[model samples]
Target chain A: MSALLDVQSLRVRFRSLGMLRALVTRTPDPFIDAVCDVSFHMRRGETLGLVGESGSGKSTIARTVMGLTPAHAGSVRFAGDELIGLSSRDYKAYRRDMTMMFQDPVGSLSPRLTVRSLITEPLRIHGIKDRNRRAEAKRLLEMVGLGEDFAQRFPHQLSGGQARRVGVARALALGPKVIIADEPTAGLDVSVQGEVLNLLARLQEELGIAMLVITHNLNVVRHITDRMAIMYLGRFVEQGPTEEIFHRPRHPYTEALLSANPQPDPDAQLARIEIKGEVPSLMNRPQGCEFHTRCPYAREHCRQVAPGVSHAGEGHVYTCHYPLNT
Target chain B: MTQASATQPIEAPAGAVLLEVRGLSLDFGSSRGRVRALRDVSVSVPRGRIVGVVGESGCGKSTLAFAIIRLLAENAMITAGEVRLEGRDLLTLTPRQMRDIRGRRVSMIFQDPMTSLNRVLSVGQHMIDIQYRDKISQADKRRRAAEALTRVGIADAESRLRDFPHQFSGGMRQRICIAMALLVEPALLLADEPTTALDATMEVQIVGLLKALQGELGCSILFVSHHLGTVAELCDDVVVMYAGEVVERGSVRDIFKRPGHPYTQALLECDPGRIHEKTRHLPTIPGSLPDLVEVPQGCIFKDRCPHAFERCQRERPPHYPVAEGHTASCHLLDETRGNHS
Candidate 1:
């Protein structure tokens, strides 16, 4: 089957300074590339994860995909239709098919609006008036395992987990084919985090909706995603099957991340690979390989030249001068 | 209400107890009513050992840390119990006395590194200012500050000290926080969710730094965090709290391998890292925490526990010995009622 969403060599840039300020400062390059040459596609009902630290441009990709942010280069095709440079009205038609769950659940919800209005607001915005709004709210709430009584309560009245459920209910209201969830289980208790993960998993399975899960938590990516991409300095250092990446990561960054992830088992021997130095500023990116400054196996060659994509196995690719597990 | 002797038989694990909280019950005057924020909570930090207090939000873990440091809010009332440090009751200490002991003897590492440090002051100034009580030359204080910064792995510590908190990254700021906290060489360090705000890589670095520093400094650390994996990895002993009560306390291996409390078991089971197989539904503990305003009469976790019996509702269970250094507060651990399941 054809991929539901196809993105090729996507790049996003944001102006660091105003035109006048840039002229005054004599800045040669006034723009910073938030995302650079990132490419990936998602098949129908396939979950893809974007794993990265803060300022890694994972969220920017989500924004660009939703047409919320403008992409500087490359193509983003949704169901065979070119999405870039589309009119706002034209983008509105695709909005029903693609939905985004923002990072903050409680903050994303309007404080004044009740849960009932919050969930049904999408339908009202989309002009889907055939169904009873109240009944529709109840149905959506039930789908997310929230009861009918929650409809009357405001966002503040709900717990972190409940607020997340309400957010899910709202996202599912329009019955989007692709859901971009950014840090869906963040700021939740362990038990509650599980509930949110499970609810998302069940809904994805039952509804056959593709997911783009962006989170720093490796465990979340490992548990839910089919295919995963590791982002560093706004580029995919490694992209492949989730299990393959977890079991045998080819990229040094991917290996460091996996090793650094704290396993719950106390007896598990932890030889954590500590990535030295802070994440370099996006405006002042490195000369050659962005991660060479901190990469344990970085050589003089790695410092002088950028590495191209190297295939490890079928569907597993890593960009590294000396990929591990060769 | 008789005093609960929860800390009676904590087998003195290898080292001497540095700080011990006994039957520490605290209440806050909330809008609704008097909220029982903490209920007979007791845990001890052995010298040179990392004791991790794990719990969800509203479970009073942070409050425990604050209470140990005597930094509770004005409305908070310590109705019962004592926070003893080195066999002395810290609760009875005067405000001036507490102030003297706070930074010099029991320093704290707050969750948010960005907000904790003064944004206006340079890292060097903050470090130098913290040592105001020391009767030393300005140059000597600055030299010592540089050494502390260097110990925490900050490169070019002397030069970097001139940069403000905003100049450093989140990981570097946290390292500075750790450095500042350890500068005093306090007997006890209360690190409340030190790595929660950090990224995965930074979190691992901070944990590793803490482990190494604890070994070198020989200072006890009370690490309070909701992250189970981090606790399992960094802490020597684990204390599980639920709705303001310590449900279980054990060595890291005992708690992870053989959790007696249903809450701990459920919590461990629900950890995404523990689940190797991808499933449609992840294990979860059903029901929300009990209301703190009108605190439950019996076991706080009874409403949510799957193995809760009639006895759990009638009376609160005491800490039952599971092993040499492990204890769990649950009715199922009651040998008198054999095989409650």
Candidate 2:
């Protein structure tokens, strides 16, 4: 089967003002490479977990794939159709087939709009002038586990979980084939987070919609994601089946990330691997591999030269000079 | 400090309770209505031990922290409760008395270090301000501030103290906040999600620092966090709060091994970390938290609790002893009547 979404050699760079001296001197502008040389693909009904730290370019990749931010380089293909060079009109049509769920539901939904209007706003924007929008909106709410009476309530009137359901309802208004959810359950309570993840899982199984979940929490990916990709700086350090990545992470960065996560087991003596030093700033990215500065098993070659993608197993791929076998 | 010094064993308790909160209830009063932020909450921190309070947002964990410190906003009123810190009633203390106790007896480190620190002041100035009213001289204050900064693992503490808050990274700023909280060597340190804003590596570092500082200072700590793993790793005792009420309280082993309350069990099952073998679906609690304004008369968790019965819906469950030093507010204890073997 063809991939639902395919990205190749994608890069995103932002141009910002340099130091005061440089600004006064009108020196050449410097660019910060937010996402660099990233490539991945998602099959239909498959959930790909994109795991990373705060400045690791995970959200940038998501935004770029959704066309919310234009990619500076590389191609994004959806079901054999190239989406990189589409016009605004064509992009609107493409957007109709894709949707994004943001991390903050309150920020995503307008406070002034009622739940009904918020959910149906996408359908209205897509020029679906049918009077059935209200009924469809009610159905969407019910699908996300909200009652029909919720249609009359505003975003502020709902709890965090309820607001997240409204966000899901809004995302599903156009019946998109793929959903890019960025940190969907970051700040929610554990139980509510489970509900949202279950909802997303059921939606994927029922609708066969491909999902790309971006988050820093490894636990979320371990449970809900079919495939997982570990991102460091602006690149994928490891990509494989979720179970394989969890059981046997090859990359040092992946190992560090997994070890850092607080396991729920009370007696499970977790030997936390403290990666020394902070993440290097994007403006002054280290030479060679972006993670080389913090990699525990970093070697001279890792500092001097970047590692290409090396196949670890049938479906597991990792980029590291010295990958861990265990 | 070297690894050997850092790895020194945390001293055993001196067998004295340092802080106790009993029957604490807080309500926010406004023209709209009264919102019960907390109800009949109680926790005790033995000296030289770490007690973790774990709950989701609006579960009143932070409110409890603020209430203990008497820093609650004007809209919030401590309807009924007693906060006894080392045998002195904090609730009965006047503003002037509380001011002396604030840093000298108990200090709190907030979640967002950036907002907690003064943006215009240098880190050194902020540290000095906390000690200004003390009998310590200016040079002594600077010396103590530098010592505290160095203790929290900040390299080149003297040089970095002159830098403003914006100059520090998220992890460094959090360390500064910890340093400020520790300047007076309070008997208790309340850390509210100190590592929430930090990344994974930084979080481990901060946790390690807190553990090391606890060993050095021998001060009891109330570590409030939503992350269960952190609780298991750092705290000796754990208090599980739900909807501003203590659902379960016990030693870390009992709470994790034999969680008495259904809400505690659901929370553990909902955590993604517990399911590692395969991609099993997480067991979500069925319903949302009850509105604080119109809380249900029965158990706060009855709506989402799978084991809830008619009695659970009609009358509030009392905190029953489940095991030695372990208690849970649930009707299931009644089901196991007289079987507390």
Candidate 3:
């Protein structure tokens, strides 16, 4: 069977403001590669995590997959149906099977809609019956661990974790085959974060849905994701099993990301693999390897030539001149 | 209460007490009723040490930070308690006394550095404005500003000072705010989620910078954050707040190794990095934070605590000793020991 969601060579770029200014001055077009030649696929009932720092083009990939943002190039096939450049009318089928959850629950939800109406709004759009929709909304709320009494509560009335649950319920309203949750547990208390994460995991199991969880949090990724992809400068630097990647990350960028997570143990050492500088501006991405600028193992070859993707092991792919934990 | 054992790795900073808070209670006046933000909360920061106030949002961690500096909202009432800085009570201080003590003595660093630092002002002017009332000449002020910026690891500080706040990155802007807070050598720094807005890598850098600066400047820090890992790495002491009250307080080593309070225990378990291997479901505290406007008198965390019993519902348990210098205000602890005294 075809993978639940197959994305091949997703290349998304936005014309930099410099490009616009260049038009006025008649200079070369300056394009920022928000997502460049990234390819990954996920099967039904599996989760693929997209992990990156801010400006790493992780969010852009999520938005593009949701069809909220137009992709400049590449194919996004959901269950063998092309999602890229589909007509508005044609997108309806794609839309119903795919829904997104945002980082900020309050911002994602409308102030005007009560919990019941907000959750049922997706069903209403898809033309589900009013009575059945209300019943489904209540079920959705219960599924996310909220009581039916919460149906009357407005977005403002809900706590951060509660609001996030409401967001989850709304995402589930349409029975989407694929759910894209961006920083699903961000800004919640660590305890509350566990609640949301558990809810998502439980839902994923019960519904047997494909999910793409985009987050900067490695902990979030390690807990729920089956397969994971690490993004740097709008490209997938590594893709592998969640356990394999966490235990033995082959890329230097992944090493930095893993080390950045402060261990709660007082005795844990925090050497912090010194990645030299910030994620560079998209306006002028470094030539050759995007990570070469901050990579600790960089040599003469790295600065001049980018390395091809190297298959490290079973279901593991990494692009590094000198891979670690061989 | 007994002190944490010497075997514990992270020792408590030995600096003299810089700020002491006792029974601090605050309520926000509203049409419905007073929203109790803080309730009988107390915390103390020793000189050149970091005391982390950690909790869920609306758990009164930030309110406690604001209360420490006596800079709560206009509608916020200091209903009870004393906030003493260097042996002087700030709660009873007149507006004039507070004005002199605020930036020069006990300054605060908020979550968003851009909001706290003026957008219009150049990085240099941000520091210069902190010393606006000083009798020092312009040259001295400029020199001090340059030195402060340099101390914060801002390279080529003198030249970079001319750049506006927008010119600096999020991490650098926060560093500038830290520099501004340190301009007058404040005794206590109230840093509330200072690195929350920055990326993970940037947070590591900022925390490292703060640790180094705290060492050099000998300033006490009431470092507030929701991230337990950050607290564990940077703080000497950690105070876990639930609802509006201080649920647990102890040295980092004591709290992390032996969390007396259920809330503390839950927080530790909830922390992602603590688990080395993959687990199916995370242990979550069942219920949500209680409504502050109508707080129940018993235990605030009673609804969520796994070990909560009938006594938790009926009576408000006072802070019980768990270990030397470690305490938890939980009925479970009170019952487990069989010694309320």
Best-performing candidate as measured by TM-score: 1
Q: Which stretches of candidate 1 lie over 4 Å from their true place?
A: B1-9, B338-341
Q: Could you give the candidate ranking by DockQ, starting with the highest?
A: 1, 3, 2
Query: On residues A1-326, what C-alpha lDDT tens digit does candidate 2 reach at each position?
Result: 87889999999988756578667977665677888888889999899999988878999998888888888899999988999877777888888778999989788889899999999999888898865977898889988989999999999998888899899999998999999999999788888898888899888899989999998888888888889988887888889999888788899888888898876666775576678877778778788877888888888898989889999777799988888964
lDDT of 3 by residue, A183-275 (tens): 998788787888788888899999998999998888889988999999888899999999999899999999888898888878785467967
Writing each residue's lDDT as its tens digit, candidate 1 over B1-341 gives 24746544367677998888889999999889899999888888888899999999999999999999999899999999988899888999999999999899999999999999999999999999999899999999999999999999998999998999999999999999999999988999999999999999999889989999999999999999999889988999999998988989989999999998989999899888898887657788888889998887878889998888898998888898888889999888878886665
Which residues of candidate 2, in runs, are more than 4 Å off? A18-29, B1-14, B135-140, B334-341
RMSD of each: 1.6, 5.6, 3.7
Answer with 1 or 3, whichever has the higher DockQ: 1
Model 3: per-residue lDDT, tens digit, B16-128? 77787777779999988999988877787777788898888888899898877777789999877778788898988898999899998988899999898888878877778
In angstroms, how far off is B156's CA in candidate 1?
A: 1.2
Q: What is candidate 3's fraction of native contacts?
A: 0.82
True-structure Cα RMSD, model 3 = 3.7
Please write out the lDDT profile of model 1 over residues A250-303, one tens digit for every residue: 888999989888989898745777788889999999978889988999999989
**TM per candidate:** 0.97, 0.94, 0.94
For each candidate in turn, the interface RMSD (Å) is 1.2, 1.5, 1.0
Q: Over the stretch B34-57, how does candidate 2's per-residue lDDT look in tens digits?
A: 999898787889999999999888
Ten consecutive residues with minimal summed lDDT in candidate 2 chain B?
A: B1-10
